[model samples]
Target: MRPRYTVVASLSRLHRTFLTAPSSSDEGFDFIFYMTNKAKSINKALNDAVPLCNNPLVLKIHEAMRYTLLSGGKRVRPMLCLAACELVGGQESTAVPGACAVEMIHASSLIQDDLPCMDDDSLRRGKPTNHKVFGEDIAVLTADALIALAVKKLASSTSFGVSPERVLRAVLEMAKAVGTEGLVAGQAADLAGEGMSLEENEVGLKHLEFIHIHKTAALLEAAAVIGAIIGGGSDEEIERLRRYARCTGLMFQVVDDVLDVTKSSEELGKTAGKDLIAGKMTYPRVMGVEKSREYAEKLNREAREHLQGFDSNKVAPLLSLADYIVNRQN
Candidate 1:
């Protein structure tokens, strides 16, 4: 028989090969090139920001942090941030630090999201969850440390040529996104609604929207708005990007709900159908699969519409991202 290591290697190769193939949205977007180059840059930045530590005392915690932060996943939040900054006539360098900060916060959120008390998942990013690998104690610390580092990264944005006022605004904005106003609120609502009747009615739908907006959309909104701010975009530009990111964020979870049942575990890089099995409230559960898919498309259109009146060339990344969100098979 082939060695176990060889089988794992083959599976990894298959995963990458499958992901490299073009999705239906590839034709209009050139998403492969755009995602490749941008994800490359973001990955490098993330690596540089979170280097391995040699101090035996703290090395394990640091390793846990780096493991999750550097794990395989699309750098969507950072890319959205950089694209939003460029959309408003800002340089990519001006946004890279903030982009990294957003990803750190996002990575931190993922760690917390998969805890035994939360989603209770055993897999993430196609591998073991942080708590599963690092122990729950260290996993919690990893999330806390990442969030702290993210704030520290953002606080130093002025060094990257962002204005003091803008940097302050961005920090405060991200704090709101992470705290009670955003992820916390959404997670609370989600936990409360879990395994209970909160679907298929106007009230349930509204509750679901609240969960999506706060849990997912809040951080995304912060990512774009902070990017726009760092890019020196005007008030109008920031608000417009906020609306766009909100729609895109909602569409992301909507599509995730659809993919959960439609795709396999390998395809999604996580436990597929687990949400349905867990009695979790998802778009498909509340709206049905077809309606959920239709809602995702509707969100895509609205997200792109918000970018109208901007330079087409500049908005290409955001436009492509919206389409990619709706059309991505995984």
Candidate 2:
């Protein structure tokens, strides 16, 4: 089938835009400053969205939800959603609901993923897995609650200034990212690949890409696309953001695989070298470490090319974000 969207501009035009130097104001743009401020904003919204002590009967599950959802991490997905919205000239307030919804979905996935039936991980984000702390049953329900609450937040929490149609579109994008076509599909493939013998090199690059694209990139794609939709970006503009998100999302997984080997347990805040021990299909495993690094660089470049036509100052956050993904130790 043909893709939903294709590049609207020629390669020359994209490269010229990519190579244009950032203006003086953008030169001084501080990633730490932006990240800190955005993280604070997101945290506040998330806290308000999923308030603890709401009801005595469900307090246990609520705790489990917040334990994982609010745990400190980079908050990359939500940040991307907000940044994409601003990139298209939308107010940050308009995107806050969508941003929080994406994070809830992301956190829900991690909770389920760390269960004994899945990755069987004991640690995540520098703490015990939700299932480990709250037991498997609560952890499962926690995932369910978060998914439902995420949709609720998206449908109800967005400002009335945004049209109902736009909010519905954003919710639809978020739903797609979580269902059979997105995270679940990628995870299922990943598990199936793990069941095969590690000695076999049949797990090729194409297969690896499929797994990562669906597993990791799917939600990230939704993040950017939903933001653009909420921000009222044109079809062509939304498509470009999707392309940028897809590249960075894949880069995220590739870099993660590399970090699994290169970083220590203390550094990564989780088990180090776990992927190698598990013999999971990864870019480093298939293409070798050096080639994987090269591939990461290529993906980063391709993602930046998609950002070319946008205002330079407006895109500084995303441009810095791409670089951050490549170089982040964890």
Candidate 3:
């Protein structure tokens, strides 16, 4: 793995040259180049941020936390948070706390969502689920601890240069995303919708969209908004970013739904086609795979439209991210 300082240096280089780079050539600013390096940056930052071995008194819980938190997967949410902050001209360091905070919240949600009472999955990112290894009780506590730690990190880990007001706002924003208004609301609605007849569960496009919006889009929305807040964006800029994030978030699920059918378990690094087995609502279940693909494409286009005002060079990461979210097979 690359060292942490190298990640910091890469981010610094982007900070200096990202906006000023010429837009004349397609190869001038490489999308893969940024995505690969930024993911490395996020992974290193996450490893450094989460307390894994500092205290023996809480070592058991820390082990469980590290099991899921450090497990391999694309660090999409945290990367989005950091990218959004940079897109709005914020220092990378200023956004690191918020980025890591969002990821912990995401991991916590996945742990809860995988409980026997919920999706009941046995594998995540090709490894056993948290509850599978830690037992259900420990899994619950581990998740709760992650959520609490996420909030604490956001409230206290921010650089002194960032105002207390912005930090407070970020904390409140993250809290809302994990509470009844966001992920919890989405999960509740999803659980309630299960076991309906095929026709009943297929339901309508509006209902399917609602589940994706709250369950998936809410956190993405919070990430973008919080990043903009820390970057000192104008209200107008933040709203536009919110819209962009909402579109990408839904597209992410739509693509995920499609890939569940198209890929194998080994390729996906999880139980493939689990959505169908659970009778859960998904884009393909209601709209068919082809239409789902079309819808993902449409959402991607719509997401890019919201970034029209930003410099093309600076927006390269965001634009590539929209494509990456949709095109990724796993």
Candidate 4:
């Protein structure tokens, strides 16, 4: 077992590592400054959305939820959502609720995935897993609460100046990502794929893609598409962003799989090499490290290609984000 001090990554340490600025080729774009500002905004919105209070009743559940939701990560999914919204000429404010909702859903997934019954992980985001810190029962309740609260957030989208129809579309789109079509399907497949020797499996690559596309990429795709929908993007624009998000999301996982081995737990803020130890199918295991890196690059290029024809100015954040995913050390 890891020492107690090592089990829970300090918020400050995780932030410095997780939120490092993305590299930008355009000298004109201050990616660092832009990310810092947006990170603060997203963090504040999330905090307001899930504040801990001595609710004469549900305090521990709220604590568990906040422990994961507010714990630092790159916030890539919500950032993608906001960037897609801005890419379609919408105000950042218009996408904040959707952004927060996507993040909550993402956090909910992470918490449940860390449960003893799921990934059975004890560490996440450099912190103790929800089930490790809170009891398993409370952790389960926390995940459920976050999902319900996320739905509540999207349910009130009209208050944010979004039309009811747009909100409904976004809600439905996000629902598909969380249910059988997305995270759930991917996770179930991942569990089934565990301990399978990739070399013996003729369809390893195909199975790997299936796992991540659903597990990691689906919510990201929904986040971007829903943001565009909320922002009143044209159908073509929404689809373009959807494609971009899918590619970016996949690339994010490819990089994550690679980092799982090359980086230490301290570097990643989570247990490192768990994938290898678990005999999980990962890019580095199936395609080799060099090939996995190449695939990530290909996915990044495709993600950027989907942004073609959009106003270059509007695409800046998304482009940097793709770069971030491919380039992140963690």
- Output the worst ten-in-a-row residue range by lDDT, candidate 2: 3-12
Instruction: Give lDDT tens digits, candidate 2, residues 68-172.
Output: 887776778889999999999988888888888899999999998888999899988667899999999999999999999989888874454888988888888
Model 4: CA > 4 A from native? 1-24
lDDT tens digits by residue: candidate 3, 36-141: 6767877777788666676876877888888888776566787788888888888877887788888889999999999999999998866789999989999999
What's the residue-level lDDT of 37 in candidate 1? Answer: 74
The whole-model C-alpha lDDT of candidate 4 against the native structure comes to 0.85
lDDT of each: 0.84, 0.83, 0.81, 0.85
78, model 4: CA deviation in Å?
A: 1.3
Residue 206 in model 4: shift from native, Å? Answer: 0.4
Candidate 3 residue-pair clash tally = 0
lDDT (0-100) at residue 198 of candidate 4?
A: 55
Off by over 4 Å in 1: 1-29, 198-202
**Predictions ranked by TM-score, top down?**
4, 1, 2, 3
| Clash totals for all candidate models | 0, 0, 0, 1
Clashes of 4: 1
- As a whole number from 0 to 100, the lDDT of residue 66 in candidate 3 is 80
Q: Which of 3 and 4 is ahead in lDDT? A: 4
Model 2 CA lDDT for position 180: 82
